[model samples]
Each structure stands twice: as structure tokens, then as C-alpha cells.
Target: MKKTGEKTWQLRLYVAGQTAKSITALANLKKICETHLAGQYEIEVIDLVQNPKLAAGDQILAIPTLVRRLPSPIKKIIGDLSNETRVLVGLDLRQG
Candidate 1:
């Protein structure tokens, strides 16, 4: 259903608010997407505070969770997103 040239790869970052961990996750996700996916990625940030119901939708068990919702296979990463290698692997941006 995604249009051509629009990223089939979809991502969502779940955070509580403007906390340090949340900020770091956002920044790190941006950097990775820019570096690897470039213009072929769509990132949607969801604030659990605003939409607490969505938490159950993704079955989120913790804060600062990154969900890759598209590109055929889904993936997830937890924590502050400070670990680049782990994120890359989780998002399938890099090989193990």
C-alpha cells in the first residue's frame, strides 16, 4: 500500500517524553536512518504519554523502544539507542 519512492520501511520510536534516553534514541535513530536508509525511510515517533493505548498495540514492555514496522520483516530495539551496532543489527542495517 505504500507509494513508490515513499519508504516501504517504516519505523516507530516509543518514548515517554523529552527525557535524556528518549532524546538519545531519537537522535541515534535519525543518524542511522540517514546513514543507511537515507531518504528511503519513514520514522514515526509515538509518545506513550499522549497515546497510552498504543502501548498495548505494540506490546511494549519498556520505554524507548524502536519498532521497525515495515520492509517485510519487523524488528525491535530497546534502551536509549546509544548502541549503534546493536541498533544496526536490530534494524537489519548491518550484518552480524
Candidate 2:
């Protein structure tokens, strides 16, 4: 996660395909970023179905996994990301 005038977020959303969970995760991520990071974030959706080779680089063993590759430390979250609160917490953001 990032705050105003802070580092840009290099996020990678790893998904298998156009599955419902994948779509939901992407949508949820977009909403979260818009509400929080806004212009300070960049999401790179990687469809494993198209390029499975990329999975190894991120050690992605699960579908719908989000990887925050920017800032000081990198963080990863796996799932549909429907829980807005949990997602925020995982990204190290404030509850408010």
C-alpha cells in the first residue's frame, strides 16, 4: 500500500483466466486502489492461461494472487479479495 506523495505501487494480479473469482479480484483491487492509492498504483494483470511461464517468477501456486512489488517490502495476497477490510489490512492500510 501507498499514501499520497509516496512510492508508486507496482501490483501484479495473477489469474488463471476469465473466471468469476479472477474478475471479482480484479474489480475489488481496482476499487481498493482507486479509494486508497489512486494514481499512485499500477496493476499488471497476468493471465496464467496465456503465459504460464510468468508464474515461476512470482512463485505463484494459486490463482487470483495479488503481488505488491513496489515500495520497501513486497507483499502477496491470494483469493477473490472480496473482503475490503481484509484487503486493506493486507496492504497495510488504515481501517478508517
Candidate with the greatest lDDT versus the true structure:
2
Per-residue lDDT tens digits for candidate 2, residues 27-90, read 9999999999977888999999999999999899989999989864888889999999988887
Candidate 1: 10-residue stretch with minimal lDDT: 1-10
Judged by TM-score, which candidate is best? Answer: 1
**Alpha-carbon shift of residue 95 in model 1 (angstroms):** 1.9
After TM-score superposition, what is the CA distance of residue 82 in candidate 1 from its true location, in Å? 0.7
What is the TM-score of candidate 2?
Answer: 0.88
lDDT of 1: 0.89
Write the residue-wise lDDT of candidate 1 on 49-88 in tens digits: 9989999998898889999998757788999989889999
**Reference-based lDDT, each prediction:** 0.89, 0.89
Q: Go through the candidates in order and give the clash count of each.
A: 0, 0
